[model samples]
Target: MASANVVDNSDHSRFDLLVDDKPAGLVAYSRRGDNIELVHTEVDPAYEGHGYGSLLARSALDAARAEGLRVWPLCPFIQSFLKQHPEYLDLVPQTQVTRFKLA
Candidate 1:
């Protein structure tokens, strides 16, 4: 896998993704207890097919993982990504696992 050049902007808090000096996409989250609610995510139309959204989600997920926080991905893309990529399964809240259809 080719390493993605994902930058953690804004002091490890709000996360945004820029590709080649342009705003390619972004992911927003709010911390709730030991879980972070993944609020939103979007990829520029031009950047949609290049997996930029996934890059943002992965970076945010990585941050949550480091903090020992379970994730509640309300963003549809991140929710779908969670389903597709099972390796990150441990990062999801066990109670919501059924809602996310991870079982």
Candidate 2:
């Protein structure tokens, strides 16, 4: 099986997951100063249930961690993912958690 690849298409404010070099899913976000607010996530219907959304979410979050940027997971999928994976909580500012309703 071909491994999927993830790329931040920042010009379009999204991160894409590619399978065989084709877009399989994307996680959209908006930049806010030194932070990013995850706005949405979508996987091509054809790729649904293939874990593309989760892959995209993980990649987007990993990128945020690598860049020393905080994430506000406004997207429900991201929020749910974070809820299940509390290890990523440190990448989100404690103060904004309440504001974003993440707490």
Candidate 3:
């Protein structure tokens, strides 16, 4: 596994995904006063299929968990990635899971 750093770009209110010194992917989201929703997960086409997206998702979810934050994955890729990786399911809100059909 590559050393992917999941950094909080609080200034921009997004998550910056870095891998091997390159910006391989990103998970963008916003806080609506209370709940934080995952708006998007984009892996550079050149970095796709290398599990970097999954890595990015994992890191992002971990951050949410650490902050006691609930996630609403509006991005299809983030939703599907969470479905495939049920281990991280605990990080997402139970109600939100149903919306993603992960419940």
- Spell out the clash pairs found in candidate 1: none
Error of 3 at 3 (Å): 4.2
lDDT of 1 at 3: 39
Query: Model 3 segments beyond 4 Å from truth?
Result: 1-3
lDDT of residue 88 for candidate 3: 75
lDDT of each: 0.78, 0.87, 0.82
Candidate 3 structure quality by residue, lDDT tens digits, 11-83: 8878887888788778889987546788988989987888888877888888888888888888898889888
Two-way lDDT contest, 2 vs 3, winner: 2
Decide which is better by TM-score, 1 or 3: 3
- Cα-lDDT of candidate 2: 0.87
Candidate 2: where are CA atoms >4 Å away? Answer: 99-103
Candidate 3 residue pairs in backbone clash:
none
Query: Quick one: RMSD of model 3?
Result: 1.9
Q: Where does candidate 1 stray beyond 4 Å?
A: 1-4, 9-13
